[model samples]
Target: MSGRFAPYGWSLVLHAVVVALLGVSLHAPAPRPQPAAAQAEAEPIQARAVDEAQVQAEVQRLRDEARRQQQQEEARRQQLRDEAQRAREVRQREEQRAAEVKRRAEEEQRQRAAAEQERKAKEAAEQKRLADLQKAAEEAEKKRIAEEKKARELEARRKQEEEARKKAAAEADLKAKMAEAQRQMEAEAQKRAQERARQNATLVQQYIADIRNKVERNWLRPATARPGMTCTVLVQQLPTGDVVNVRITRGSGDAVFDRSVEIAVHKATPLPPPPVPELWEREIEFIFEAR
Candidate 1:
């Protein structure tokens, strides 16, 4: 039993030595290839053994640096996103303002168009009203002219009829005068003389009455004149019935009243003609009395 245990112990010692060598190799750095010329010129280089604890500390520092870099990249990405969002908002605000400006401009244009249209419409309406008034005026003028022409024609016709009637009356009077002349020739000379005197007297009375009527028509009585006031006025006239002079033959005591009557007689100039030419006088005396 002792002999079998001794052989087992030797095998264990050899395995233990092999395990230690494997552990050292696992921890060692990989060898780098050197140039042949450098290896020949230099002395034998001794390799420094690696420290496991220091290597572990360096690996941990690298991991920490990598983590910090990742965090910085994330922060940068977030900042870029925020800037993009702000830019998008600014663009939206600008678009809204532009839309508002365009809407206001369009509204102003519409208002101006409406105002212009209304002005034109008013002008057209005014023109139409004026045209209507002018048309009515023209129609009224035409009617007035036509009526005046008709009235003139009627007046001319009436004048013609009046002239014709006067001519016919003159012819009848001429025939009667001729018959009377024949009768006068057959009468005695003394009877004819008496008849002529009577006719002369009648003519004188009628002529005096006509003069009185004309003077009375033109007379303007003075306030001083009384009802019983009377005066005689002497008047001188021409063959054409025009008054040449007027004189007061008698006054009614009031000089102003007498002067007024004299003026009235002169104003009634061109005294009525006598029926008989022989009855006409250059100077005649007439009485003025208030009615």
Candidate 2:
């Protein structure tokens, strides 16, 4: 029992000492030994026993109060630890959220940069295509102009050649007409000359016949004249066809017959006139005969 209470032995001893001092102060004076002295002494001893029991009970109550206070301090320390752990967890979650936001912002910036570059490239390609089309159109226009110029030149040359050919043909036709006209004029002159000659011949024959008939009608047949007697006579006449002279070119051997033929030609005066003036002869000879 002493070993079990050894941990609180000093506290129990101090309590017992305090209780003994209080009992001494509260005790009455001892009575003188007499017939009632034993009873008084016995009461003092019981009172001392009661006081010791009360001291023991008070020490036990003090020890129970100290134990309760220590348990309440331990509970407060556990609650503080739990609060600190919860605060640390909240700080870590906030830092993670900040990092995620920064990463998303950086990705969006990269996408914007790529889109800008693609837009510039597309614009440059469109400009180049428009320039190529303009160049092609200019070349086509130049070619068309050159072809038109060449065609116009060809047409002009063809027209010139056609005009030259027509001029030459006209000249050839005029020359042919002039040559034919010249030939026709020469043939007409020859035909007129032949007609005049024939007309002159006929007029001369008619005049000779008229002279013979007139001389025969006027001739008086001389007795010395015979049928074989013939002579040539020449006569001259005025524009009025009157005979002016008569000569015998060849006379017959009989002089009387020649004179008779001469006298007959003179008596036949005023010979027949020619039909055309071109047929009139200033001198003429005729044969005279008595037949």
Candidate 3:
């Protein structure tokens, strides 16, 4: 088994095999004595001792080599198994790392999708809220406009009614004033007419007195006249107070007295003119008495 003794051990096994071969050849049967003078010379006989211990040592060396080769083969197989196990562990680690990467990627994708959905939902809600607000504003505006229009119409109607009432009051006031004016004018006219009539009557009396005084001044007393005699005489006159006719409407019993009254009336001619034009008449009558 020691490297230093291996060559000596191989040399000893070779020598043993040569000694066995020589022994067989030397111990073979002698041939018949060759005829004298034709026989070859015989070599010297060499004797070698076979050592059992050296043979045993050689066999042990062969066994040791075989054992060493078997140990080498088993070592190689163990190394191959270790290398395969290491490869399998490396492949498993790589696969685990790849699976982790894929899981992370998938999770990121899911999160992004969720975020996008949330954003879209919020945007839609905002749009709907804006639309609702706009619709409410429009309705409120319409209501305000309608109320304003109604208020304006009511105000216009009220103003028109007020104007109509004022107009009616004015017309009533005007009618009352006109009726009062008419009454005052009629009363004034009646008062003026009565004053004129009174003045005309006074003037008529004065004229009648003048006529009687003139007739008496012109009378000549009849000697046959009796005291307390009276006569009614009718006289007719013109606008110039000139007598046109005279007659006795009632005579005294004394014909001479009545005749004298008629004569006096005629002598009175051109009787006094009336003070007013309207008082002049075509006929006049007076009473005469003897004083």
Q: Candidate 2 on 1-291: residue-level lDDT in tens?
A: 454334355554655776676577559675465557577676777786686567556655544543444444446446656766677677667677777777777777777777777777777777778878888888888888888888888888778777777777777777767766776776676676667767666767778778878888988888888897888888888877788888888878888888887787788888888878777776778887678
- Which TM-score value belongs to model 1? 0.34
Total clashes, candidate 3?
1
Better of 2 and 3 by lDDT: 3
Clashing pairs in 3: 241-270
- Per-residue accuracy of model 3 over 83-161 as CA lDDT, tens digit each: 7788888888888888888888888888888888888888888888888888888988898888888888888887787
Model 1: per-residue Cα lDDT over 177-236, one tens digit each: 776776666565557767877777777777877887788888898888888788888999
Candidate models: Cα lDDT each = 0.75, 0.73, 0.75
Question: What's the lDDT for residue 29 in model 1?
Answer: 69
Off by over 4 Å in 2: 1-190
Per-candidate TM-scores read: 0.34, 0.36, 0.39
TM-score comparison, 1 vs 3, better candidate: 3
- CA RMSD, predictions in order: 30.6, 16.5, 13.3
Prediction 2 TM-score vs. true: 0.36
Candidate 2: which pairs clash? none
